[model samples]
Target: MKAMIFAAGLGTRLKPLTDTMPKALIRVGGKPLLQHVIEKLKGSGFDEIIINIHHFADQIIDFVESNDYFDIRIEFSDERDRLLDTGGGVKKASWFFDDHKPFLIHNVDILSNIDLRSLYKIHELNNSEATLVVSDRPTSRYLLFDDSLQLKGWLNKTNGETKSHFPDINPDNYNKLAFSGIHILNTSILSYMQHFPDKFSIIDFYLSICSKVRVAGYTPVNLKMIDVGKPGSPEEAESLLL
Candidate 1:
């Protein structure tokens, strides 16, 4: 039904490109990164979309208007005055997802081949509060899950640290899944986040209460994906998708 593109980041990693433009405006495969994400969502049958804007916010707004919103319903959640982190950005745009159905949250710079319709279906079938796209990809940090793939803990490989709600949990026994920066969240999750601060990471918030709630991961294999997070990422994404 509806989706929100997380495009408000400063995108410092993209360096010179982001100096004059937001990362969402960076081109990959001859189109802006934001446009790619929007087209993917539209192709997946999600016509109503919301994008948050912060870095060079006006430029993003102007570009969206220029495209006539790519012939779909598009709205902007303004964060020009303050840049809220992932969880806070979603919280700020909670009103847009008032239809009581599950909504998607996708990063602007991520390119993936995951089926959005099927992912949503899985989320519905599981009756979950949220379903994060997890993979066996390597990363500095990972979300840990139990045998049933239930959200259990978090681990930071760089520092050899771990956090688990289960007192008797063993890090050696849990599975590590790299988060794909894509998620489907039920509206009920908003109520659970009422007590959180306005600028916290969604991952942190999830780990804080995963013990009491349902935050499952969807680990699909043979999935082609890429994160256009750095200056040289566009070249790589072109080879993957174009």
Candidate 2:
């Protein structure tokens, strides 16, 4: 299986740590966050991987080279010229997923106990264009899903704003789930994304076409996860991951 790790972001939240190193290189659980993700994915049956790099691009490259890429088939998507957000990063790395199978996309900073194999099996069985991993955790923003777990829209609790592809249905009619920064996407949906901007969130792009396509959400029960991007996350990660 193939997967892409989004590691190009200039993680402003980590401040001085990020000022000296890319977020991908931030040590967590006695290793870089990217290393944790790579080991996890490799153990989860992913054989090929591509990681995007921008902030401290060379450092990430050097780190991967230093470790011999953990003995997996690893590739780097250089984003040193311009930083592309989630959607754009996926679009730019489309060539890596050319095998036509559904591939996984994950965040470098996300440390999770998500079962990648189970998620992939669910995507295959559901036969959806994409399956977003979600949870019932408390979050200010959420993705709206219908009774059948189909993507319907998005809502921001902090600002009381809503965006939906299906205008006829009330936003309140859908169940809200917090996105887990992980998803499996079939390459068949790539054709519709050519018109997207060079930099855009996948959430925005998903909502733009959900009405015409099958975008489902999967919320695993009792998901243990965290976004390891803040300044104190390393310490927190040591406690949780170690």
Candidate 3:
């Protein structure tokens, strides 16, 4: 199967490190962050991968070419002219994925131990348009799902703001699952994203279309995930992720 790594971000959170180099190039356990993600995907039988580049775009390109893609077929969805955010970045590279199969997306900074094979299997079994890895963890924002694991709303904990597709009635039995920055999406999702221009978040795109499509969440409760966006997070990731 094919996958795309969202490595184009300027990575404002990583500060000095990202100011000089792209976040994907940041090292963890003696290897670049992008390398780790690619290795993980390759282990799951996803040998063909595409990475979007923007911040220190040339450096990322050079590094990937130097390593010979670590034995996996790697392609770059170049965003040198304009750094398209998650939604636009994926939309730009839609042609790389064959319409017959689903594609995986992972952020360069999110290191996780979730079983990709299991997640892929569940997505295929459900015949879902998209399946996101979510956890019952604390976060500033969360994707709300009903008892059936159907995405129902989005909540911003900082401001206590909530937006639900079922606005008329309050959802009484929903769970808040923090998105783990990993997702498996079928090609059909591209058709729904046709209207989004230049730069936009995939999260907002999902919320906009949740009422019409089959967007579900896969909760691997026991899996360990680390959003190594902050300086402190890298410490948390040190022991959990290799």
TM-score of each: 0.97, 0.97, 0.95
Q: Give model 3 RMSD, 1 decimal.
A: 1.5
How many angstroms is residue 47 displaced in model 2 relative to the true structure, after the best TM-score fit?
A: 0.8
Model 3 C-alpha lDDT per residue in residues 32-83, reported as the tens digit of each score: 8888898899999998999999889999999988998778889999999998
The top-ranked prediction according to lDDT is 1
From the highest TM-score down, the ranking of the candidates is: 1, 2, 3
TM-score of 1: 0.97
Q: What lDDT does the true structure give each of the candidates?
A: 0.91, 0.90, 0.87
Where does candidate 3 have its weakest 10-residue lDDT segment?
A: 164-173
For model 3 the TM-score comes to 0.95
The alpha-carbon root-mean-square deviation between model 2 and the true structure, to one decimal in Å, is: 1.1
User: What are the clash counts of all predictions, listed in order?
Assistant: 0, 0, 0
Segments of candidate 2 deviating more than 4 angstroms: none
